[model samples]
Target: MATDHQQCPVAVIGAGVMGTAIATTVLGSGLPVVLLDVGQAELDRAERTIEIQLRHARMMDALPSGRAPGRLVTTTSSSALAGARAVVEAVVEHEATKVGVLTDVAGIVDADTPLISNTSGIPIDTLADPLPRPQQLIGTHFMNPAYLIDLVEVIRGRRTDEATVTAVTELLAALNRRAVVVRDSPGFVTSRLLHPMLNDAARLVDEDVATAEDVDRLMVGCLGHRTGPLRTADLIGLDNLVDSLAALYERTGEQRYRPCEQLLAKVHDGHLGQKSGRGFYDYREALS
Candidate 1:
């Protein structure tokens, strides 16, 4: 039997860009999903956002070999999460915030219902500690714009069971995501490798090595990066990046993990990214 045929509905909390993308991708694979948010307003906004993205995806499908997917639903109640087999928490990155949400949501589901985090830098070992079934807790870090990215790092915490990891990988395969199993580390391999590199790029800008645009262009054109760190930061949202930086710094105690001064200033100034419409570049008018 097909995995989708036997698969239970997926519950995605947070309904942010990444959450909705994951939900959308899963729904495309014929799996139903319930996107839950803490507030009704947020739930409504996310539902609309998913609809817009669905339309764009359908347009892409209409191109020569089209295959647009059907839509999914959203909810604001924990009660709606009753029958979900897997819950992906894409909530705020604060440790306390995550633990609180997961702890609460974990109580309302079966012990077999896997609890996954959409977190990127936070350690799975730390986040899984307070959940109901720690063995069933894992990290499923989807790249930004999850609908567009192919990589989904499936991280196994100290208490996470092999079976839990296996089930998540199987589900990702169904959604057409490339899932990579990595050990539960402070920052994990990807974040450890990436933050240092992005930090170096930020240092270049802080030290006046090149303008932000020039540094970004050089990296993409010369270094063969699809998207340079500076621009990537803009898209990732500086606040989110800063949070990751703090987590990595505290975990590794590495000076390189310390976010650049200029970067910190931008974040403090509220020039977060495309969401705020300004960061390393000016976009006050365009965004307004």
Candidate 2:
């Protein structure tokens, strides 16, 4: 099981924030990266995001003195990943979408290439069920701001092989991150506990027990958290939070995992947090 660097160029699918962050981190680690998405516009946006991150790193003296941004290649086709040693799928958190992307990636890469998913809560076995080689399909849930997050949740499906886990864990280590290997469970460790708290916060807002601001203030002040649970939900996006909650409910049939009505209402209104410019707080002006 060769690490990402040993394989040279790594293929990172999806050009969203997480995808760009993973690609940038890989490139910063001195491995060539091929970033693939559905359209040229998406690729262009990913490129810009990557460049901005790179420049920021340089300003902070995080990148090697002579490292050029040219280490990254952007494309609209998965075929460009033919030479990649491994592929990481950071697409949307939908089961069908992730299965489709992983199926397509399996077709393009070598049989032994490690296929990783950055799903926050979807069960690994469910995502791997459709792939030809489920043993290679593992979860590498990197927190947001992938480049800066030192902790990565490595999830192993029932069929996931030790070699695949070792390869991914070693690759993360190479990039100066810690890996906490966990079994394939809905929400794994972080999301299982975190989402319930976030949903409870939404419940408080729904019940008018406290305003979103007050609840957040309590978490930051009383709980000693850097960010309030509601603000964190805003950052995670209302739609995403709902999806995670739904996934947990579907898997566990637990009432607590059911998304609060207010969360659902906000998603329906399209106030999807930072990306959509509004959620618990308005970001329209700041987004512009």
- Candidate with best TM-score: 2
Any residue pairs clashing in model 2, and if so which? none
The ten-residue window of minimal lDDT in model 2 covers 61-70
Per-residue alpha-carbon lDDT of model 1 for 1-288, expressed as tens digits?
223323568889887667777777776656778889878887787777777666665566521133445347777788887768688998877888889988998888777677899887899989888876899899988876676667788898989998788878887876778898999887787778887787788789889989889988998999898888888888777788788888889888988888888779888899887767798877678655
Q: How many clashes would you count in candidate 1?
A: 1
The C-alpha local distance difference test score for the whole of candidate 2 amounts to 0.85
Q: What is the lDDT of candidate 1?
A: 0.79
31-137 per-residue lDDT for model 2 (tens digits): 78899999999899888888777777666666544555538888887788775767899888789999999998888777678899989899999998888889989
Best by lDDT: 2
Off by over 4 Å in 1: 1-7, 58-70, 282-288
lDDT of each: 0.79, 0.85
